[model samples]
Target: MNKIVDLTLNYTNDFTGFSKETSRTIKKDGWNASILTFYSHCGTHMDAPIHFNVSQQTIDKIPVSDFVGKAWVIDVREVGSKGLITVNHIPNDVLNDFVSGDSLVFWTGWSQYVNIPKYRDELPRISKDLANWCVDNKVKMIGVEPPSVADVNNIEEVTKIHQILLKSVVIIEGLTNLEKLQSNCVELIALPLKIEGGDGSPARVIAIEKQ
Candidate 1:
């Protein structure tokens, strides 16, 4: 049996960068469909290097294989509001086993405040040191529960971290329900819309719990 946990923030008409219009309904059109308007980088999304001008590669240009991988979660629940996350936060055992191509996830408890301003304005963030560490370690992808891996309000911090990490690895953000994952490691699948020339796109991210 495989246990799959959704690691994406639920979206709704009220959420930021998302709007839904009833285009068709069972009662009106004998079917059900809606027009969804979404911002490419909103909600649970994957960032392409081009998002930060790190490269010309768009989300669609990223290899599909890069979206699937064995991902290890580093529990950073104690990383309080606006806390700084460094490589030291990762457990030694996990770090010892971590290798090139293995994705990394920071399981911060920030998702609980998704509906509030703090979720974006005062979220915990990954430090520049950690970003560089990921690059040096050749991490394939890095996931974070916050809407962003760095302080979104700080353009310098956000741009620097995104550039440092995106240049070397793909990024998954705005994740939720990571606490539901029962294992330290899981098979991660995060598929983004294949928009041509897209800087980034919202992704449906899930984790197949280790069995």
Candidate 2:
């Protein structure tokens, strides 16, 4: 049997406490509820094309078939802080194994900094060349354990990377717990919330190891 690993982050309020709460008392019983305050990009999330382009497809309009598929996890842990993950970081043998429609998951070892400001502001990023490679190679989706594929502080680089990949590929961000998965190839499933017209939505990402 294959082992399943969850790669989603836990959602919480305001990075601290609940944003809103309500309670109702009926007879001798009571009910309580709370509204969550989270960024759509928070936790493990899917980036719809509309996230970068207004005229592009919204989250709900995204094809459900794109959410699950064979995936490759490339490890670039040796890359330094704020380093660029270029084509070279991907092993030649790994590139040879890529199929036109396979999803690519990058393990930059950045998930270790989640909840820290540095995780968003100072982290390794995918370079333009790598983005172009994915486009030219016909990658179905790109998943990363970091919050984004580009430097969070560099808007221009971020925009360019998003524009390039978002044009034809789904982007999965904020993945967690990928270090637990030992295989380089696995079945990936990133299911986003069915929010109509949403630019992007949080998702529950998982990997199924092959026996």
Clashing residue pairs in all predictions, respectively, total 0, 0
Q: Write the per-residue lDDT of candidate 2 for residues 1-211, one digit (tens) a residue.
A: 9999999887765343224444444544565555566567777788888888935699999889999899988988888589888888777888888889998998888888877888888888888999999989988989988888898688898999999999788999988887899999999999999999888888988999988
RMSD to the hidden true structure, all candidates: 1.0, 2.3
Models 1 onward score TM values of: 0.97, 0.91
Model 2 backbone overlap count: 0
Candidate 2 accuracy as lDDT: 0.85
lDDT of 1 by residue, 24-126 (tens): 9999899999899999878899999999999999988999999999999999988899999998998999988998899999988888888789899989999
The stretch of ten residues in a row with the least summed lDDT in candidate 1 is: 8-17
Backbone clash total, candidate 1: 0
Any residue pairs clashing in model 1, and if so which?
Answer: none
